[model samples]
Target chain A: MFSNDSQIGDFVKSAPKPKNEKERLAALKRLEILDTLPEQSYDDITKIASYVCQAPIALVSLIDGDRQWFKSRVGLDATETPRDIAFCAHAILEEELFYVPDSSKDERFADNPLVTGHPNVAFYAGAPLETAEGHRLGTLCVIDNKPRVFTDEQKDILTMLSRQVTQLLEYRVINENLKRETKIAKTMTRFFENSQDLMCVAGTDGFFKEVSPSFTEVLGYAVSELLGRPFLDFVHKDDIALTIKEVGKLAQGHRTVNFQNRYQTKDGRWLILSWTSSPSADGSTIYAIARDSTVEIQKQNELLKSYEEIKATRAELVRPKEEAIEASNAKSRFLANMSHELRTPMNAILGYSDLLIEEIDSSQPAVIEDVKKIKSAGDHLMRLINEILDLSKVEAGKMGVSRDTFKVAEVIGQVEGLVRSLIGKNQNKLAFDISKAPAAFNTDQEKYKQILINLISNSAKFTKSGNICVRVFEDNAAGVALMVTEISDSGIGIPTDKLESIFSEFSQVDESTTRLYGGTGLGLSICRKFADILGGKLSVKSELGKGSTFTLRLPSLAAKKSKSSSSQAPSKKGSKRAA
Target chain B: MKRVLVIEDNEINQDLIARRLVKKGYKVDFAIDGEKGLQLIESLQPDIVLLDMNLPVMDGWQVAEASKVNPKTKHIPIIALTAHAMAGDREKTLAAGCDEYQSKPIVFDELMKKIEKCLGSV
Candidate 1:
């Protein structure tokens, strides 16, 4: 682009550029010598060129894109000049010294401002400053005002000085590269020394050849104690075999990452260390980084132990509950067996006694009377077995309820029939007041009958010639119909403290009451449980030696609401069909 | 004549049942276990069978199911006699094909009434 043909109208004719002008400019720029402060190295060369060439001015001038710049100058007023009139611009194109015998006589410089104006006609010369690669940059040349001729010796001296300037430029590049590398080396050294990880180098001799200062901080060991020692000396005995295998791989130029091992600290505590290692190019040394993982490993172990403990504790908690279920099942089986075994003999005793009574004649009244005693004793024992069986069924939560729509009179008539003989035992007067009783109520008829029979029978046992009244009433006080059968007796009453426990299984008013009154004490508890199954409650009130009233309250559900209507017949047939 | 077969394991209970049955003006046959009871049910073609639950070779439940399925003896009505006081015995025995169930220490009057009812149904 430095064209010589574009200066047609200008008084200052530009010099012709070389064929490789772009590369020549590149070489000049690479020296980085343009417009630089005067260095003593280049200034010494310029001073010598000025004195020996016997010229008034000398400069180490470099050719730039738009100007010729001087690196060092002597007897020079300005540091740079335009490339269009620069004498060094033409010098860069020459292989050796370029000479202008007199500027006024040269076509390129005849109209140049330096020659036509104040500085007047001048003699100029420049030696091409060439790189080792043979691209000429600029020149170290001397200038003198007034036209003069340069001898071959002066051209030779100028050529020699230009080479020295080129050498100085090349030296600057090498100096900068060295400075950059040194800074990087220093930073890398700081990273190795200050890093928290245990950075180390190990030789093939199995010794710790080098270690970062972090190793001392983590292991509680002095640097002197660790260097030159086999690193395996501190490894846990259990992990040494595996650690040796990893190190052997590292020795063969293989990397070892994700390797874990345990090492002993200075105070004889073991710490887990995880490592990443690489082999050197020649495989003579290994570079590795490690972090202490002791706390992390311990926490993992603690979590595993807690999981195991919880599983064991849960199993312990479950065992007793399973055993309790199994025990209850066994008890139920035993009760079933006992019921069969006891009732079978009683059936024979009672049946055979009845047969004998029928077969005996009136002349044998004593024999008939003994047969009657056998039947009566059998009846008492049979009742005790039945009551115990009923209580067992309730306790097992297996007692079935058979609800039906029944007239209140049906159950009351049955209860009155059952308690007739018991009423004769003490001559207890019985009465019924059914004024407010529901006409037809829905509930389990059999269970309700049993409750009434037990209550009246209990009253007959306690009273001697006292009145027992059965009063049935319906109440709608709570927006729901409840049929209450209140049976009160004028009998030897129970104490206040004994009232609650009397309803517990096998509990009586007093321990001697079981002996005095001929009955098992399970009657009341069974009555309460049956009342509960029917969705009702049985409660009692008593004053000592006055009377006791037992209240059995049951829901009088409408037949349409109940599953079994009275039309289904008054029996357990409806409940059986559901089963 | 209405013939009733009484199956009982205990000899005393068997004797007691036979006496009561004979006195009630019905001809009675006796089998000590359920195996004989089933055999007699086919051979004699009794009007009813009183099958006791605790017996050798077969129980009342097995006898009831076997007899009910048999074409030769299926016409006979079975009354299950058991000392087992399970509250669900009525449904349980009926489910096993027995026509009636009565708990033991049998009130002879109640049992006789049940027997007559089963006979009357047939």
Candidate 2:
């Protein structure tokens, strides 16, 4: 025993330590077997180790920094022992089997607590368990109460069991890693299958490698049909070039956000898709998410088409209106020029005739009479020219209203004074009734006076030995205050049919009225037009063989000027003639 | 006697106005166009000018503007004899420096009054 202690102590002291003790301990920890209940697989290996070595106790022990922890133990109650006295710790220092004939005889363990205390281990043999990278983590060891020598076969069996232990540890770690990877893959697949957005993986060769189930919902194609097909095959022809360009960018390891394109569906419909894609780090594949934008795109197109149509229609309508206005303006310009030409000669005729009448002697009554007739004829011709020019001015919309404040009675008095002579010549009685009229009002005074003159003259011309009444008063209707002038005559009455027609251009009661009245038939029409320009209305009531009464209703205050008239002046040369 | 210049393009109108002014005891000189009328004004230096608006070579507005700008002819009272009896004629002619405006198909009495008034103002 004295020689055994020194020899075992010498053997233990000469044992080679592992090259990486820290890494070996780390590998044992990675197996997560310390402080655990005995597992049947590990216990079975320990039991086989003991049976082959003919030992009473066996264990699968892991070497920590200061302790040896047993993963499985047979014929032993303690789960751990101090590393200084542990056979497995000593075994882990060697690449093969480590044996001690008697632990009490060994100098290193002669005074050890486990050797002198309960279990009283006397014999030990252990095989170091090594990782694939040569890390000796722990051992499969057998122990006995009596000192013994391990046979070569027993050592070989222990080594085989230790190799199985290493294999089992490697398998357990690989299986756990596989389980974690499968869980993550299952979650990702569920998200892909249930997501509304189209998710896909595409190869750098432009072919679809995988597509989410949402592919069928958005593009109307089965996943089987889309797989292995070039992504451009489903792209609209007009969009394929753009898709290729974007895909090329992806192939260059660029990420594209919101790249839009149109895809043709299986049923021959278009789906507008906005895609965000990123190329894999290796540039061998791309991951993309596509959002459907078909409805928004189509609505934008329809709106653009409608806008174009409306613009075209507006241009079409505006052209003819502008042309008509241009034509009317041209006519007005011609009339103004013509009137100047006509009146220049008329001026000479009238001026010369008055001189002639004055120069003729009173003794030659016959020559005086002839000159008077020429003067009268010239005056009549001037009136006709003036009337024609005035009608043209109103028709061309060149007439504008000029507003001023004037006394009502003053205007009526002037009208009465001007028309009194004609009424006397016709043997008509003229009466004025203007008591209720406003003393003064705001309106186009000249136009009002002209309208009154035309009406009174028409009355006097058609009336002989009859009464002409001029009534001016204020009236209210429809929440508007109006200045009403009624001119009633008791002379040749107009038929009901001719009442409205009389206001038309060059219209008269009949053909005979023009002959008998000696008028250009433009007076009433001019009056009505002037009233309209002043924002008023003119109406006449008459019966056959009775008399005609013409009413002029004018707003007391003028409204805003018409759009064309606001910028325009009254016909430059022809307005006075018309008035 | 007050000398009057009648600037008119038409022969008949010129003759008629010249005869009337002569009968009215005024010496009347006439020109066929505005250029001749301006020339006559320079030489004749008449008391009044009956300027026709539509004249050859230069229009009455240009003639009026020119006459008013000249130191010698600006003093002669001009009565614009216009065939344009429109609303703006008087203001337009007056704005060009005419003393009075009269429309065509002339009433001799009205023209005589305008001439006398212009002569009086000067």
Candidate 3:
């Protein structure tokens, strides 16, 4: 009943035959299936039928043009068999239940390939599957290796279950189509809501028809405000013509790639925008998305402003330092000029005084007295000029610190000798107190001695009577302490309020003291500057009209003590002055 | 005899230094300002020029440069005299075409040594 073609051959042709040609054709169409895809609803039923009947083969079969095709199978895996030898085709034709019992014993079935090979119709059963329209589509059937018998109740239930199986397959096909629709809807909704850029659809007349939430969120406009409004109305006036040209191209179904321009916000600010537009098939709308670049534009402007400010401030700051240096250089030049004029006359005064001292007789009292006054005044002037020169050298950073080493005792002696003339002239009683001294120390001995001389001289100049004490001592605690102080009688002491200020350049207790004492007021300041350079300190403590004491502290070095040069220099001076 | 040109504005300083140079047997010439110094340099062709850096009508720097450039007077060596002991003044004065730099109140012995060196080298 299944075969008109011979590809499946005599293996299927010698089996069961359809009782009539009309029944054979009816059997073929009764399956009501051709080129149908397999479904699990029917396939599962066949699997269960094979297991329950304890057969090695089962099929849910539908007949095709030349063979019976399987919709589902448990053991037999072929999709089709030739029509002439199809056992299921014959079974499907019969209205009553069809069964083959023990094919090896029945003469008609013995030589059949269904008994000997593929189907081996030793046992078989088929119940037709009828669709809702009463079109029989296929069958649920089973097979067994040994003959199987079915009771009346079993046959009725098998046919009823087969009908139920057909209904479930049809339902599944309808459900698959529904699930496809739901998935497509879900995907489209996600694409619309989750996009980051502003997306919109506009009509051919240039009115916005649809816009994403990003449009309202980014531009601070609502859908009700934008809907049906001409899209160009929101564009910056300068960008309107360009946008119109791009939109015209968009209407021709030509996609605009990265078209960029500005659009004005409701707040009257222009926002930079870049977007691509695509024309829909109907040519009635444009689909586009844009990025807002206003924040980036504002940030770039702010950076440029700050850079300009920094450049301006940089020039403003550098100008003062240069000017200050130039002013200092100018001051040094003036000092150098004055020093030249002052020194020439000062040399003449000292030179003529030297000649006068030799020529004048000491026995002639008035002549000696007048010569003494000139020599003394000239000596004072020379000291003043020296001080001016020293201050200038220090300010210009030209003064060199001598590297020669000397004994602390030698420095103390030199300080005493240097101030002796000042002390004698000031009429101050002076004392020498030596607690201890390192035999020698390494330092710029010349500068060290000069520092001592200046401090002591200033002290002597201020003090008129009482006593001046020179004390030398060493401290392992830090370095060394040398105190050369004046305990004096006839002058007012430094005010406590002016103690720190006295170390400042050109500072004096009052304007009167500068006039009365006749000082450049640079002595103490130069001493302190020198002390600072020595990494030491010079300090004073005084009682008005009683006296003042000045102390100089220095650092000590322990190693390389065999500095014979320093020892020798101090010993010569120390012995000569010890008397 | 070596010739000396003293360019100075101050009569006292100029007389003091020039009298000492004349006593030492050098022929001395003088200019009161930078412009006169250049004029004197060309006409006198002195062996050594003592230039005061500060003067009216173009300072010593301008005088030294003009004197050093003129072919007729450029052979004369100049000693720059400055009253300022400022840093870099020496360098600047030398760079302006003075053969040496010395600060004043002029140490006669030191100034003489520098002058002799410039004259011997020239």
Candidate 4:
């Protein structure tokens, strides 16, 4: 069909194809200008190109698969010719103007059919129609029947016209796309006017080039107030910095997805808007859609505030226990300081008093006894201070227990030795009734001895020419083992009401008990604290001028080879023996 | 008479210990601070040392460690004196290589027993 339509029966049909012939031909066809009727836009470019170059023939030749089709022509009769003989085909391979001063001497086209045939071309100049993407689609070229050279000015003019042709192609394609989308455009126009979402077109100049009617509705602004003004003017003062940052990203060709910022409405309220936008191909405009997220943002803020409130409320419930722990720690530290400072003066006082009693002459018996009173009083003050320190340690939880397995009788024996001298001084007869005591007990040996020492010593101090008997009893109740020790003394007994008060810290049966008995009054309280450490209870039952029987009850452990004795002990908790 | 050195800071304590030691018929010398005490310990080379552990110039533990570390003075026995007889005081004195420790407001008789034992060992 091509042979019949063109005068090319004798034309050479084999010129070298471009390395990208497949892609180049495909792009050329997509322009849809090949073999079509000539239009005035392309024709005008060729006419100007030929007049500027002062050439006899000019054509806007687009290279197709096997032919060079003229989309527009000046002084050319045939519309197209075989691709193998077309000069524009080879011209497309060059980046800039492809000029042949003499086609007769050029090796590649020396014998081209058009060169020696109808057009009889000897000189040619073509400026490649390179698209913005660098695709050389075709060329706006001029030809002469005889050999000639194009001037520098004429060459530049051809190049400029070639670019004009490429732009005309771009406009044509855009017009076609717009025509194809007319039906969708009509529907979109209705949606853009009536829909609630804010649709807009923005420019890199920071102004809203166009806005849908919903923009005016949502922001309560007229189209006149919204369109020409800078979009940043409507953004909240706090959000302008971020708004400019997002605009910079769009200018860099980055699509904005879910970008949110606050905008001031015409009615003087802040509206939180969430936006998605894409930049136009030229990167000079932005196409965007936004949703009014004010309600959603309010809901999120409410949720966050409630969560913070819950956290604060929980902290309030836990504050007092922590404060109590801190207070106890402070008490322990103060007591430690007192313990270190108070003893230094006492050491000198007691030490010098002892020296006085020792060095005095034997003849001055009254002087010796007077110094003896000083020594005794010093001793009494020292004991009171020591007892107060010990009770303070117990209250602060600084007392530590180290548990071990030992014979109950063995610990009781140690206590007996410590209190025997006091017992003799008081003229009190002591008795032990440990007939039913266990062979071995698992507990802190020192704490157990301390508890026993306090109870025995208190009994000794309280009684004069009276009897103090300690009785031990073991019971297996409800599969739980308990060891109970009773120290019953026939002493100046406590009154019924005073029995419970005696166990409290710094309390005596009566004020006279402290004077006559000469006790610090912290003995029973310290013993009770020690008992508490050993997981035991201390209680007493007494009558005035009859006797007081103090009971020490403990969770008695059955001796065994155990890994952790403390963990094996049943979790024992009951009401404290409080008066 | 065996010469005894008493390292005590307080003048009353120094006088008390000195007079007591003199009464016991031992020639007694006194130094007021740990630096002077360490110096007297090296120069005098007394038969025994009575060191107050909580002295201002040098604590008893440092003096003990310093004296024990020196080959010349290491042979001299040291008896440490502390004010408050806290539970860990004895172990601390022993760790410092003190031969014996006595609590302050010293009972001159009990301190005498410790001193005799230390001197008897020498």
Q: Report fnat, model 2.
A: 0.32
The sequence of per-residue lDDT tens digits that candidate 4 reaches over residues B9-116 is 887788778878898899999988899999999999999999999898788899999999989899999999987554457667988989998976587778999999
Superposed Cα deviation of residue A454, candidate 1 (Å): 3.4
Query: How much is B105 displaced in model 2, in angstroms?
Result: 4.1
True contacts kept of each: 0.53, 0.32, 0.00, 0.05
Per-residue lDDT of A1-579 in model 4, one digit per residue for the tens?
223325434544465777777777677777777778989988888988878888889999888887888899998999888777788887988888999989877766666777767788899999898877567778999999889978999988999889899999888778888887997899989988888889998998998988999888889999988886898999988889998999889988999998999988988999999999999988899999999999998999999989889988878877888888888878877876796677667767877777787798889999989988988888878777766676677777666555567787877887787788999997899999889988877666666676778888898887889999998878777466777888999887877777778889889877877888878888898888878866788998888788788898877433432535655554432223331
Error of 4 at A368 (Å): 6.4
Question: Which sections of candidate 4 miss by over 4 Å?
Answer: A1-180, A313-324, A358-377, A387-421, A424-427, A432-452, A461-465, A469-579, B1-4, B18-27, B34-49, B56-58, B62-79, B91-100, B104-122
DockQ, candidate 3, comes to 0.06
List the pairs of residues colliding in candidate 1.
none
Q: State chain A's TM-score for model 4.
A: 0.58
DockQ of 1: 0.48
Docking class of 3: incorrect
Task: Report the number of the highest-TM-score candidate.
Answer: 1
lDDT of 4 at A103: 81
Looking at candidate 4, what is the lDDT of residue A556? Answer: 47
lDDT of 2 by residue, A1-579 (tens): 444543443433323346787777777777776777667889899988888888999988888888788888889988887776677767887767888898776876665556666788888888887888788878888999899988888888898999999888788779878888899999999999998999999988989999998999878898888995888999988998889899899999999999999888889988899999999998889999998888877898899999999998998999899998888888887886686578767867777788788888899999989999998898888777787787677777666555667788888888777777788888999999989988897677767887898899999999889999988888976578788899999988988777789988778988988899877788899899888877889999987778989999998653444434654665644677787
- Please state the interface RMSD for every predicted structure, separated by commas: 2.3, 2.9, 6.4, 4.1
Ranking by TM-score: 1, 2, 4, 3
Q: Candidate 2 chain A — worst ten consecutive residues by lDDT sum?
A: A6-15
User: Can you list the residue pairs that collide in candidate 4?
Assistant: none
- Model 3 chain B weakest 10-residue run by lDDT: B83-92
Query: Relative to the true structure, how large is the alpha-carbon lDDT of every model?
Result: 0.84, 0.83, 0.72, 0.83
